[model samples]
Target: MIKAQGLRKTFTTRSRKGTQTVEAVRGVDLQVGKGEIFGVLGPNGAGKTTTIRMLATLIAPDAGQAVIADHDLLKEPAAVRRKLGYVSQAGGVEDIMSARAQIMMAARIHGVADPKRAADDVLKRFDLTEMADRPGRTLSGGQKRRVSIALGLVHDPPLLFLDEPTTGLDPQNRANLWDRIKQLRESGTSVLLSTHYLDEADVLCDRLVIVDHGQIVAEGTPAELKRGVSGDVITLRVDGLETAAETLKPFAREIRVDEDVLRVYVDDGEHTLPALLRTLEERGIRLSSIALDRCTLDDVFLAHTGRSLRDTGADA
Candidate 1:
């Protein structure tokens, strides 16, 4: 379980334009319930990782208050570390270290009663027993990732912090990791996952917060956030954008103009599409394309941020 308020972090970076102050996390408020998979969903530079790092005690927040697993974040960092497992985006593997060796070292660091038993148990759990003796460089991407997670779990902590855990894995590997994460929740381990993948967040998180520009724009269950969009989406590509938007206004709850698309939100898209088409015809609007789709998390994002998550480069 985790709770934090107004957590902030900033950095100075030197670019061609010279040194500039960057507020990676302006002020983020987060909460994760016990036995649940909570997600921080956002774009690449949206500060999800910065927030997670703060909560995991890997980085100190510029200003905020937090309690991770009942330990004060600022005052009891060591205690917090003992209560949580942190698997960073890097996969935390050494090229020369064997999977079994890495896990045993982790167990030993955590002071497990039996290091070999702990390592062996995790290797078997993650199905890495076959490659347990192989060095990290010899393992496949999926195997290396699974071994990283196994290392995190060797100590059997109650909470886990996963930062972009599946960023580079293939679909099969991502699915495998997802199943394992879901199992962790079922087994009563709380997880805080930071990801830019919409499908991953939608499928894995019990509740999630959407962040953009270093701020949380929305927070709710996936279904709840999608429901907040309040209607189906009808996307259209017409020659006369503004005129088409005006003509379709009465029939639409809202309209968002993208570069080549006009997304019209309406409660009755099927019925309204005909009227919209008729109105467009009367207005002499040349319709290039049209489509109807159920509202999605992306739509929710568009409503709150005036930009699609896809457009924001959240996809892998």
Candidate 2:
């Protein structure tokens, strides 16, 4: 439902250091299939939002071409807008307006045949009926978020752009939103979600692209991406990190030492741990702790970017 090629955007900002031009997006390309939940995964400032804005026609790309629901982004922005729904991080709902009022207003603006019915349907679909009469300011963060999503669906668009849709919600609400998003896909709405949360992408996306420094470093299904980094991860807190790393080097496929922790990637963590412990003991190496875990999306991110997602500052 969406295709983008060579998308790029740059922003100029002034700081005490002086004016600097930041390349928010650089030649990013995307292809989202119909009825698929595609994710653009990245840290803040990694160009995920900029790429979404360009594809959604909310902002023009500096250099790129895109088509959403068969409408050219640059040549037919209005038509693109008609086929797509956008729920930004900071929802645009008015604080004073009740959930029902806001949804109704959106339906009316979208020229829905029956604004009230459409609004009510979406409110029910998003499970916001109980809070429909509550003012946006009076609702909880999760409630307001649901209302925002309802507003986006009021027009019955075929595609949706959700930029960090669950950034601030608690775990319960995040999971709830995930279910709603899954329903959208089942109902044949193509969703392009941009989020920094690894677990979100793993659980919610059919396919995803990892962006860093304004470029895509990797792209695939959650399982496919996790497979890119082989083996279970073994973390050992030892007294002599360097010696421990050398001792395990022969058995490990990959090794990373951070502070006092020696992390090794091995084909079989459970099988190797016992032998590794015996070897360490024979070498008189004292281990404070040891852990074995399956490779996760976070591990994939670290392999691609050399940093954890949480370490990437919220602003970036």
The best candidate by lDDT is 1
lDDT of 2: 0.88
Give the alpha carbon lDDT tens digit for every residue of 1-316 in model 1: 8889999999999999999999999889988999999999998999988898888888999999999899999999999999999899998999998999999999999989999999998888888899999989999888888998998999999999899999889999999999999999998999999998989999999999999989999999999998788668999999978878888889877888987899999997888878888888888889899999888888888899888899887793
Q: lDDT per model, in order?
A: 0.91, 0.88
**199 in model 2: Cα distance from truth in Å?**
1.4
Instruction: Check candidate 1 and list the clashing pairs.
Output: none
Off by over 4 Å in 2: 314-316
Q: What is the per-residue lDDT of model 2 for residues 1-316, given as tens digits with 9 covering 90 to 100?
A: 9888999999999999999999999899899999999999988889988888888788899998988899999999999999999999997878998999999999988889999999889988988888899878998888888888888999999999999999888899888889999999999999999998888998999999999999999999999987778678898899889988998898788888754577788878899889998999999999899999987777788788777676786422
TM-score of each: 0.95, 0.95
RMSD of candidate 1 to the truth, in angstroms, is 1.6
